[model samples]
Target: MTEYMPIMLDVRDMRVLVVGGGRIAGRKARQLAEAGADITLISPEAEPEIRELEAAGTLRWLRREASEEDVDGYRIVYAASGDETLNERIAEAARRQGALVNAASRAQAGNFIHPAVLRRGRLIVTASTSGAGPSAASALIRELDERFGDEYETYAEFLYFMRKKVRETVIEPETRHRLMRKLAETDILDQIRQDTFVPWSETEAAAWIEREREE
Candidate 1:
């Protein structure tokens, strides 16, 4: 069994091939499309949903059986044809041809595992169990979804905006560090969650730090 390492990939404008058109393949294809990959999906027959996306030109459709040649020239490939032997074969060929693969059945043939991901505006969370406990991972996501709501979206963005201002204004490393932590500790995020947050000026956020420095 391969111990998988988790990392995010920048697939924008990258070529990705999905070797199936069933429901499973359609789901993965939709996700890759959302991540901005230039997708080519190959299948002799496809679900109506996948065909609908193809009709819209969201991804190029190759209405044919996938071959080893189809596995080449792609940055990433999804082996999801539901045929165990062919899926494994495609995974092996994809790896040999220098492409990352996400296999629906076999884990060892691929380099990475996909975890259950939760994305809020700027807050993204991923839960996985090394592919052993997918149910547990999904249950954890439900718990997290309840605790972290839309409030986190605005709160996270606010913190980022203020961090940049602190970088430019706060010269002392120690003082800058303290202010960054303080910004989070203040009731600001709570305010954002409750829909009571008001935008603050640069001096408004940094004023207390200036006071401490002068003292």
Candidate 2:
């Protein structure tokens, strides 16, 4: 078994092919499209939700069985026809075309694998068992979701804004890192989760920066 090297690819404007119309295929296609890929789904028939996306012009839908020709021009290919044999065959053709292929039934057959993910705006947490156990990864993700509430997304965005400002304000690189780390370790996340946080104000951040400079 090949060890998977984890990566978060930016699929924006990349040509992605999904060669199945089943629910799992549809879900994977939707995630690709949501990430700004130019998605083309080739399946004789697709799940209702995927068909709806086609209707909405979110993706190009080829209402036909996948052929070798369908693999051309795709940067990424997802083989998810639910037939393990067919998926592997599709994976073979896609790899020949120099496309990175992900087969639903067989992780080792593909160059890449997906981890269970939780997202809150710019914040994303991923759980993976290194292809050892997907169900365990999913369970771990669910547990993390319980621990990190939706408010964490807002917390992430807030930190993004502040961190950028800190970079601009704190001229010293080491000082900026210390200030950012200090802010992250504070009770802010807890306060947000408990709904006891004052409406976020840059005033507190400014004060903290000043105090850090003094110390």
RMSD of each: 2.8, 2.2
Tens-place lDDT digits, model 2, residues 1-215: 57677888999999999989999998998898788989999888889989888887879989888877778888999998877888888898989888899999888767788999999889999998978999999999999999888889878987998897798788988898888888888888888888887755678778778887677
Q: Give me the runs in candidate 2 sitting further than 4 Å from their true place.
A: 170-172, 202-207
lDDT of 1 by residue, 1-76 (tens): 4567778888999999999889989998888888888999998999987888888788988998888778878989
Segments in model 1 whose C-alpha atoms lie over 4 Å from true places: 164-179, 201-215
The true-versus-predicted C-alpha distance at residue 34 of model 1, in Å, is: 1.2
Q: Rate the local accuracy (lDDT) of all candidates.
A: 0.84, 0.87
Clashes of 2: 0
What does the lDDT come to for candidate 2?
0.87
Q: Distance (Å) between predicted and true CA of 35, model 1?
A: 1.2
